[model samples]
Target: MGERVLVAHQPAYWPWCGYFSRLLDVDELVLLDHVQFSERGWQHRNTVADRYGRPVRLTVPVRRDFGQRLTEVRIAEPDFRERHWRTLSETYRRAPHFNRFADRLQELYAQSWTHLVDLNEAVTRLILDALDLKVTLVRTSGAPPSGTKTAALVDLCRRHQADVLRVGTGAGAYLDAGLLERAGIRIEVAAYAPTPYGRARSRPAGLSVLDLLMHEGPRARAVLMAGARTAPFTSTPREVHA
Candidate 1:
């Protein structure tokens, strides 16, 4: 088996390129769902294209109750699923290879999910399954208690006996990666670069990962794997299609 790696992150919305981009660098992907749900988090918000060339935010209503845990907090948007699907479809319909993967994208958004963990897992599965990756997907909530947020991830890594911990560039800001390194696990941070992929709709460059995935199709996986060839890491906050 390949080296085991742990990826712990907050719940993110659909179309997020950075999260999907990180999956290419790890053997196991663990979503940190046990953390508190930030109000303005990427969990319920993401960008989609309008007439403008940049990506704009679309928000979904999640319950304010944090005690119920992420997997239990209901996403209260009545027509949010349909709305997101139509909006993405309309915007990406003109993409270079949009038609080829449109039906699959539609099917992905159409599925119903009850928990936040399931939602994230389902979306991740859709993207990777399309690319035919065999990485194991696990949830933080499902694992044995790991103490605090950062330590929980570390404990998770220890439990899984991972050889490495794959983290986002931003993780160094708060996570004590040295602890894992001290435990004999290699720590690698992944940086994501948004490449320009043109669609027939004429949106700006690098809207969201979904824009890249839908237009690129089978090549999307290769594109993600090749992320290392770009800049060392991507921290620029820019929007393409909105």
Candidate 2:
């Protein structure tokens, strides 16, 4: 049987291009919906260019409950969809590829959504399709994960029958690779350093994947994957968790 490779992360809002780069090759991508929600994380906010071609943030207000998991978090406002769509449409209306993806994207925003993670999945799926990535999408909400940090990650790999656990470098500093190696999971880390791509605008690098798609269109896949590198399976993590 072919080796099953997997990647997982907290589902994000209109995630930056870096989020999707490493996901391209994985057999499964798990959304960590069962994990605790992060109020200041990208889960509820992302940046894009304004009509004036400057960086602007679109934030989703959530009904805050301390210690609540992402699956339990709810959108605090009802009008955010319309407002966010307006911001996107008004800003990218003139983008070379906006017309190609505008309709479906508009329809997504038009849907009534309650859970923030559900909304995130809807958009991330669309973006993945746009990039032509065929990785199977799963969420921890389907099968509750066990443990915390690397233990949790190893449990996820075992649950999914994954032979390789390919994680983003965001967690590299804290991963307990030795634990995973002992569990018989080969660990690889994917990293992307933001580089200039066709501009949806003059906003700083690391803007949402929308910025890449609107400007680069079909070639956005290559642009998103550019400069992305994966660290080979390391017997040791950069740092060991206690």
Q: Which candidate tops lDDT?
A: 2
Q: Rate the local accuracy (lDDT) of all candidates.
A: 0.65, 0.84
Query: What local lDDT score does residue 6 receive in model 2, on the 0 to 100 scale?
Result: 75
lDDT value for candidate 2?
0.84
Predicted candidate 2 versus true structure: per-residue lDDT over 15-50, tens digit per residue? 998789888777568999998999889999999986
- Alpha carbon lDDT of residue 86, candidate 2? 93
* Per-model RMSD to reference: 5.0, 3.6
Score candidate 1 by lDDT.
0.65
Off by over 4 Å in 1: 50-52, 66-68, 199-206, 229-242
Model 1 agreement with the true structure over 1-242: per-residue lDDT tens digits: 87776666766666466677766655666666766677666776667655345676666666678555666667776567788778877776776667876787777667775555566567667666776777777676665455775566678778878777676666646666566667777766666655555444354544556666666777877776655321222234222221
TM-score of each: 0.81, 0.91
Which candidate leads the pack in TM-score?
2
Instruction: Give the Å shift of residue 19 in candidate 1.
Output: 1.5
| Candidate 2, number of clashes | 0
lDDT of 1 at 128: 68
